[model samples]
Target chain A: MPKQAPVPDELSKPFWDACNERRLVVQNCTACNRMQYPPEQTCSECGSEHNLEWREVSGRGKVNGYCVMHDSRIRLLQADQPFNIVVIELEEDPAIKFLSHLPGTPVDQVPVGASVLVDFQEVGPGQLIHEWRVVG
Target chain B: MAPTGWFPTTRNRSQEGLGVWEHRGKVAVVGIGNSPTARRWDETADTSVGAWAISAAQKALDEAGISRDEVDGVVTCPQGMGSPWAPNPIPEDFAKAYEPTDNPDDGLTGVSADWIVKNMGLKNVKATYHTPACISPALCAGAQVVGDGEASTVLVIRGTGNFSGRYGQYGAAAGDTASGPGQWTNPWGWQLIPQIAYGFDQYCRKYGSSHDRMAPFVLNQRKNGALFPEGYYYQHRPDDLKISVEEYLSARWICKPMNIYDCDMPIHTAGAFLLTTAERAVNMKQKPVYVLNHVSQRAKVRSSVETLDETEAFTDSIARKVYEGSGLTASELDICNPYDGFTLFTQYFLEGLQWHGVQRGEAHDFYAGDISVKGPHPFSSSGGNNGNGRTRWWNQLDCIQQLRGTAGERQVTLKAETALAGAFTPNMSDWMVYGTSPD
Candidate 1:
């Protein structure tokens, strides 16, 4: 079986679309001037509906924390066992976070608080998911 | 003084004092019951999820010495079959495909109050509620029902059923696409373990704690769980379930910072508690464990998983609420049974409550000390979910038992006048305090 890919709904489509184009975007609340992620219909800060605007970001972040999975419950990812799932706090908004396997980083060696940059991976046809890479 | 306008301002009787919980000592838990914990749903004729719920309810009623006809209220946290993360099957589709029998108790994965009422033949049930969380909140709701006179005797139950498959396996998708939050998490193989492990890792790094300091807690839970007759290990393989410090330290990692022992064993089980007004409870068969106060808080997290700081904030808020509501201090607690569904939660609760002067980041050091039932600060002697199977109610059950002097071999050596219990994570959780007297 192929690895699971993001099947974006209407609200998340733009965010995923930006990823496909090798860009990272976050939802900027026009009303509150606050940033959000994973797409919401309303501004979380101001609760203003239809006031969310997509804004492209530098895609830079820092490793907040991480865990190395020695086992895989997902069958397709079993072959790629012993991977790291790193929590990335986006440079755009520390509150807006993302999970990444941190592909190139060595297992059990995630440097917490180290800087990282977003990288996209095509797991399925036209499905570009965002991952992170350690920045020197 | 009377108000001049239509809005009278004579402090509503219940809200007389700001932040004062009027429901303190208004309700009491008289009895607790548990079905035999099992690794899987034993395919026995009388061992369905609904059946287990009914059995637990019956035991509670019996233990309370309250007749079935006296049960006037029911509250349940229903459990569905299959992976908990799987999308719930449409009710109509599920009923048509799976629920064939008209008997409410038969062929049930999730057990509801209506089914329990029908199965137990509870004729006087006037109030029914479903708390989508776990048994802690169900008990809280039950207490409210009794305290508010919605019912004189209320039974709160939580039942879990496991199907034949890997626990928490992702539901088979229609295609290779992951929708919803799974789109972000599942794609990277991020499941519950990694999510929690991340929190533990952050906690260790921030606090200078290490996994080695956690062995005492793990071993303590196993020791107590081995003695708990209703637990899965004790019921199934009592002889082989014991663990040593070396064994826990050497245990293989499911995820770094979270070995297999750090996680609670999921099992098919159901637990029920009988609650009533403190007035009525004083005359019941068992000694009344007064419901002093409870706080249910939902933390605001910016991300899918709560950060360590967020968890600490959540814990601190809960601790303050619990103390303010009950008018009790952490020093006054005789025993504590914090949720250990994930062992790390226990550390969070200890540090959060500062129980017995355990300061921030000092829980690991506290754990390194004596945490046995006979220790100054007794913790989770009932084996919790870590020692017991994941019944999710053992903490509360043990609290009630400890307060009532009925915990048998696992009872604390101290004069157990007061106890505390909680469920789920430090963030978004339910916590309650129980005492031997209403005061």
Candidate 2:
């Protein structure tokens, strides 16, 4: 079976669309001038729904933490067992974190606190999802 | 302290005043009942979730010497039918046939308060509550109801069912499109284990802790579980209970920094507690374990999983509130039963509470010492869910039993007058302080 693709909803469609274009965008509150991710209807910082706008980010982050998956509950990814799942703390806003497999990174080699750059992978046709890669 | 009748507000970090715990010393846990833990649905035994729940509740009521007619309130978690990720629905025919009577209890997927009242022929039930939270919160709610004079006696129960399959397997049947939060994680095959593994990873990096330091805690819990007759390991896998440090160290990694032993086993089980006013508990059969205070908090997670800092703050808030509300200090706790659903949670709870002066980021070091039932501070003597099964009841039950002097072989050698028990995770969790005396 193929890897699962992200099913975009009304709230997340713009984010996925931006990913398809190889851009990383987060919700920025005009009132508070803070960023939020996994796009919410209302700005998480200032709670201003109308004041929220999508802004492209540097796609640069640091490894907050990571794990090596020796076992997977999702059967589709079992063949890729012992993979690395890295938590990327966005440089734009450390609070806005993302989980990425850091594809091509060897298992148990996730460098905590190391810088990373966002990259997109197509899990399904026309469906690209954002991931991260460690920067030298 | 008289009944102030004033609701205690959240105290500032100063932790000075004895906040009015409205239910403190008012509600008493008089009896506890647990069903035999099973690995999965036993076709041979032919038990239903409803049957287990009712049986556990009945055992509790019997121990309390309280008739079904006397129960005035029922509080329960109604969604323990199967794994939340992937549930095995009860067959329509079996469900219908199982309960042929009018207002029949579902007894398969879940059991509601009304169904329990009806199924048990409870006569005087005046209040009913169904909470999706864990067992600790359910009991806390029941105690609050009784303390508020809505009901004099209440029954708090939880039943968990397991179907035969690998736990938490998001089968291909779940489809190829990850929705909502999964859209971000599932596409990368990042699931619950890895989510927690991230937290542990952060803990190890920040605090200089390692899984090797966690071996003694795991081995201790397994030893305790082996001795606990009511637990799953004691009942089913007696020979496997003798876990060693070598075995624990060599345990296959479910996720890095977390061995298979770090996770609690999901099982088929039910547990119930009977609570009444302290006034009524005096006339009951067992010694009353006073409900000193309880704290429930929402997780402060701005992302998919809570950061180590967020979890620490969350648990610290709970600990401060519990101590202030109960008018007790962490030093006064005779036993500690932090939730060991995941072994890391135990560390979070202990360090969060600062029990016995265990400083921040020092729980791993604290576990390096003697933490057995005979230790200075008996930690998770009931073996918790890690040693037992994922019933989420052992910690509280052990608290009651320890305070009541009925823990048998698992009893702490110390005074064991007061204990702290909690459930779920450090981020989103509930905790209660139990005492031998009301004051």
Candidate 3:
């Protein structure tokens, strides 16, 4: 099976569109001035419905945590077996973290709290996914 | 500690009434039943969704000495009945029989209250199905129905042939066919195993815990599994009972920070609990376990925010609410059946419930003999999901058995006068405390 692609809904379209352009974006609440991932219709912090905006974020952040997958439930993920999945806490807002794969980083080198940069890859015809790689 | 009194408050079943501790304990679990875990190859012509459900329900009813005609209320979880890959012998998936007319989702996406009434061949009954929460929701719903005078006898049933039926595995097919949030996780290689592993990895980072620290919890579960004759690992893989730290670490890692032992063994099984008013249960054949409290809560936020908030997932507030409602402290609980979907959950729950004031960073004696059936504080003596069968809400069944003093060799030494059962899944959490006798 091909890699699992997220079925972007109306609320998440802009976030995916930005990812398609190799730019990382998240929903920034105007009221609370906080960033949210996995875009939702309403601002989770302030409950502001009308002022939510998609803001591009500098995807440089410290690794909140990570896991090295030696086996995957999905066969596609196992194609590149023994991969690393990292949760990156974006610098724009430390609370706003994104879940992504650490494509090229070795298991031991994928350190928790290490600075990382988001890198984009085209996994399908029109689908693009963001990955994280450790940076000095 | 002995079980608390029943219905400490006056007759009021409204939102305000919920605050009153007396509103609870009016309902009791009168009967319990379980079906053997099956494998993919164990399918027969009769193992349809309806057949499996009927088998457990019949057993529970027989234990209660209540006939089909006596049941006035029914609650069910059909989450497992839909897998097209499983050989469900029923003519069609149960969802198709009564898909909500309003909802757009089709196929086995939903199960209506009418479906259970029809399939179980029961007469006029107040039936509600498809309100799927983790197994605890059905228990809470069943208890409330009897307590509120909606029904004299309520039957709560949960059956999942998912493991044997759905591609002979715990998870569904990946990629394009993936359903729910699972599809979203796949592209990032965030399958269920790793996603959960990350939860523990984050916890370890915050609390400074290690594989060695968590190892004993898994070992304790395996030890309990050996005592549980029904556990698949106990019966088939007897060697699992003797797992060592070296064997656990050397085992091929499914995900970093988590080995094969950390994951729950998915098996095909079904469990049912029969609930009725304390008055009705007085005449029942078996001992009635009083339902002290059934409280559920959801996090204020959803998605990544909640997922990343390691503390929120196992918030102390969840346990505080249960303790406040049940009027029972951690010490008062003779037995606690915390959700063990993952072995790591044991720590999350122990800390969340403030069991012995155990904090996130405090050292826990998971290796103490008290963690076993004969110990003072036995955890999921039925081996939990770790070693026992992974039937949703199976912990509740174990709690009932413990309180009824029918757990056989695995029964807790406290006489199980007061027991706590908690379930945490995704964004939702629920807890219920049971007692041996009414106040």
| DockQ scores of the candidates | 0.58, 0.69, 0.54
Q: How much DockQ does model 2 earn?
A: 0.69
Over 4 Å off, model 3:
A1-3, B1-18, B81-83, B86-115, B163-173, B176-184, B233-242, B300-309
Model 1 lDDT per residue over B340-362, tens place: 98897678888878888998899
Considering only the true interface residues, what is the Cα RMSD of candidate 2 after superposition?
1.7
Residues B311-414, model 3: lDDT tens digits = 54545666776777777787777777777777755676777676655656553444443577787657667677776756646577778888888888888876
Global Cα lDDT for candidate 1: 0.77
Q: What is the TM-score of chain B alone in each candidate?
A: 0.89, 0.91, 0.83
For A1-136, candidate 2 gives per-residue lDDT tens digits of 2568888899899999999999999888899998877788897767779998899999999988888888888777778788887888999789888988887678898788899999888888898888888888
lDDT for model 3 = 0.67
Query: Which candidate would rank higher by DockQ, 1 or 3?
Result: 1
Ranking by lDDT: 2, 1, 3
Q: Against the true structure, whose lDDT is highest?
A: 2
Tens digits of per-residue lDDT, candidate 1, A1-136, equal 2468888899899988998999998889888888887677777778898888999999999998888888767766766778888899989789888988887788888888999999988888887878889989
Q: lDDT at B183 for candidate 2?
A: 79
Candidate that would win on DockQ: 2
